[model samples]
Target: MTAITGALAMAVAMGLGRFFYTPVLPAMMTGLGLGPAEAGWIASANYVGYLLGAVLAAYGWAEGIERKVAISGLVATALLLLAMGVSSNVLVLAIIRFLAGLASAFVMVFTSAIVLSHGLAASKPWVQSSHFGGVGAGITISAAMFGLIILADSGWRTAWIMAAVLAFAGLAVVMRYLPRDIVRTGPARKEPPLAWTPSLAALTIAYGIFGFGYIVTATFLVAIVRVGGGSSLFEAGVWLATGIAAAPSVAYWMPAVRRVGHANVFALGCLVEAIGVAASVLVPLPAGPVIGGILLGGTFIMVTAFGLQLGRQLANESPRRALALMTAAFGTGQILGPVVAGYLADWSGSYTWASLAAAAGLLASGAIVLIYCRPRAA
Candidate 1:
């Protein structure tokens, strides 16, 4: 039942609320006649709201906001995705997306705490990884839906309605099933306890840089390919396939990291991720995007999975504050990736500059991970 709750919670509260935007955005821009800057601004608004939510939750002001909060957040996000289809005003849509993103941040904090307390254990890396896969699953669903309806010349509203329906169903499951005790891992660690150990701080900074790097490609990879002259189906297919394949890829990636050491494993992930991003800059071909998606899909999720694990391994802080600090670093970087990419694209008149910048950040993160993380004993 707890696993079911985690799965459903992720599908609604964390997954669709956070990830569906990018997959559907291409169809949106085409059907709705939206501009790049406006689209970027909407994405930025989501991140800003996410940032605020993370900071608030990390500071202990977010106590009353747990299981029920997740249900409300998912409900709002589902409705907003539908609302986006009907509303023509960009400002209105941005505000809706911002709130949804904020909702997503809080949901992640709560659900992740649940997992750490019960679901996350050494014997269950693959099982725990599936929960993270929910985000990709949401993206796949949204992208596939958009591809089918878009070819039919159906409006973006159809996609939003679908997202809403999915969310409402997930919410019903959460209400019926999620455990009520909410205290993850015995009594919670004392409030205001120290959160940033040397290892934890390195972990946090590395997580932030990873966030900065990954979002640039995830947010804009399809758009860049579209601009570079790839067909719509090509972009959509790669996106969906990445989301679908990512669940299993963690099995391959995390163990390799565990054996090779976290620092080197993380470096390899960054290296591969950078290669994919760099390809997006040059190839503009179907092969380039597909390969990029495979690599990106495989490792990014592992980085996240391990970041949380690594922090917990090293820290003596509350699950709430420790996870929040690590994730807040991640979320902060994610929030910036798109807006910065947008500005670079706007000024340079090409997506290459933005992508290259993202690639550089990934390498930089690799350096941080290698330097700061102590090598495990062989």
Candidate 2:
């Protein structure tokens, strides 16, 4: 039940709250006459808030009240989605996205701590996979909703309204199933500080690079389809493919982790995702975006799961702090990806060069892991 609830929470917070923007971006662009540069600015605003939220979560301030913090995030997410629906001004939208990003980060940190800790205590590692699967599930749901809105000839505003309703429904499930008093009611104990090591530093760098590599396509895949003259339905289908591939990715890669170790698997996933990112702009329309979307969906989530798991292992004495540090690195990369990609798209009139650069970053990320973080033989 805890695992299921956690998945629902993630679906609401991450799938809808954060990533739903990707699917909705094209419609917003069409309706609002937004250029890539403006879109990038809005996306970067969210990432900025995410970076701040990660830093805050790293502190001990919210330790014992993680559940409450998570719930607050959910509430804020739902409201912000509604707020998005009502706003047309670029600055207002950016502010709302920024607040929403902050809320999503809070949900991510607290909910993962709750769910992963429970999974570890229960000796059921599958719980971790199921919990993360919520993100893919949520993405799938949003894609479906977007398709329905497209069928109705509704705009992005309607999509946001529907998203708010969905988030509220997920929030209700989490409130009912997730225990009210999961954490002890008292002052939180202080955790030992995370020790900086060469391996850990390399992993952090790799994780940040992975963030920059994946986000370019993640942010603009639907828009890219539009540029290729694909119908709205086809665009939604491509996103749906991504969600479908993502749903079971963590579970699918768990066996690989046992065989190759986390860092190696992480490296391999980066290589695979780099192929997908390159495909997005290199290959011709339809097939190219579809294949790229699949690869993106299939690897990004698994890599994310492994990266955080490796961070926890490396910072055994301070998992939460390590997660915060890694998340901050990732957020920093995320902030740069869209701005760079957006302006490049506006200038070059295509995503080819920007995407190729991102793929290079992924390749470098993989190399870093293989060189510096690979586990030694016993």
Candidate 3:
């Protein structure tokens, strides 16, 4: 029950709150006459809020009230979605996205703390995978909703309203099923501090690189398809493909992790995702986006899970802090990716060069992880 609830929470927070923007972006652009640069700024604003939220979550302030925090974030996310629906101004949208990003990070950090801790206590590690899968599930739902809206000839504003309703529904389920006992209301127990190491540092940097590399495609894939003259249905289908691939990625990659260890699996995922990112723009129409979305959906979340898991192992006693550090690094890269890609797209009139550069970053990220964080012999 906890695992299912956790997945629902993630679907609401990440899939709808964070990424619904991608599918809706094309419509917003068409309706609002937004250039790529403006879109990039709005995306960056959300990442900036995410960064700040990560930093805040690192402080152990929510030690006994993680559930409260997570619930608050969900509420904020739903409200922000509605706020987005009512606003057409660029600055207002950016501000709303920024707040939404903050809410998302809070939900992510707190929910993971809740679900992963429960999984550990129950000796059911698969719970973590289920929790992560919520992201893909949410994305699938968003894509379907947007596709329906497009077919109905409804505008982006309606899409945002629909997102808000979906979020509220998820919130209700989460509130009902997410265990209240997980909250530790007694005095906080002391844990060992995180011991920073060279390998940890390298992993952090690589994680950031992965963030930059993947985000370009994640943010703009739908737009790219639209620009390539694909119909609205095709664009939604591509995004749907991505979500479907993402749904089981963690389970699919677990075997590889056992065989090659976390760092190796992380490195390999990066390489695979890099190919997808480059292919999104470099390859031609239908095949390009389809292959790109599948590979990307197949790898990004798996890599994300491994990266956080590795960070937790390296931190020893301070798993939350480690998670926060990794999130901060990722947020930094995310903040840069869309803005850079957006401006580059505006300047070049295509996403090719920006995407290639992002792919290069992913390659470098893989190399760094493989070289610096390789597993020691048993």
| Highest-lDDT candidate | 3
TM-score of each: 0.91, 0.97, 0.97
Model 3 Cα RMSD, 1 decimal: 1.5
lDDT (Cα, 0-100) at 134 in candidate 3: 94
For residues 255-330, write the lDDT of model 3, one tens digit per residue: 8888888899888999999999888988899999999999999998899888999888778678789999899999
Q: Candidate 2 clashing pairs?
A: none
Clashes per candidate, residues 3 or more apart or on different chains:
0, 0, 0
lDDT for model 1 = 0.73
Instruction: Summarize candidate 1's per-residue lDDT along 1-378 as a digit string, tens digits.
Output: 666566667767555776777767777788778766667888878887887777767775445456666666666777876787687678888898888878887777776665445655434655566666666566667667667865776766777788888888778877787666454435634466754666667768988999899888888877877887877777778778777766555566766866786667777888888888888777757777777777788778777776676666666456567777777788889878988888888788877888888899999888887777755311
Clashes of 3: 0
- Compare candidates 1 and 3 on lDDT and give the better one: 3
Q: List runs of model 3 lying over 4 Å from the truth.
A: 181-187, 190-192, 376-378
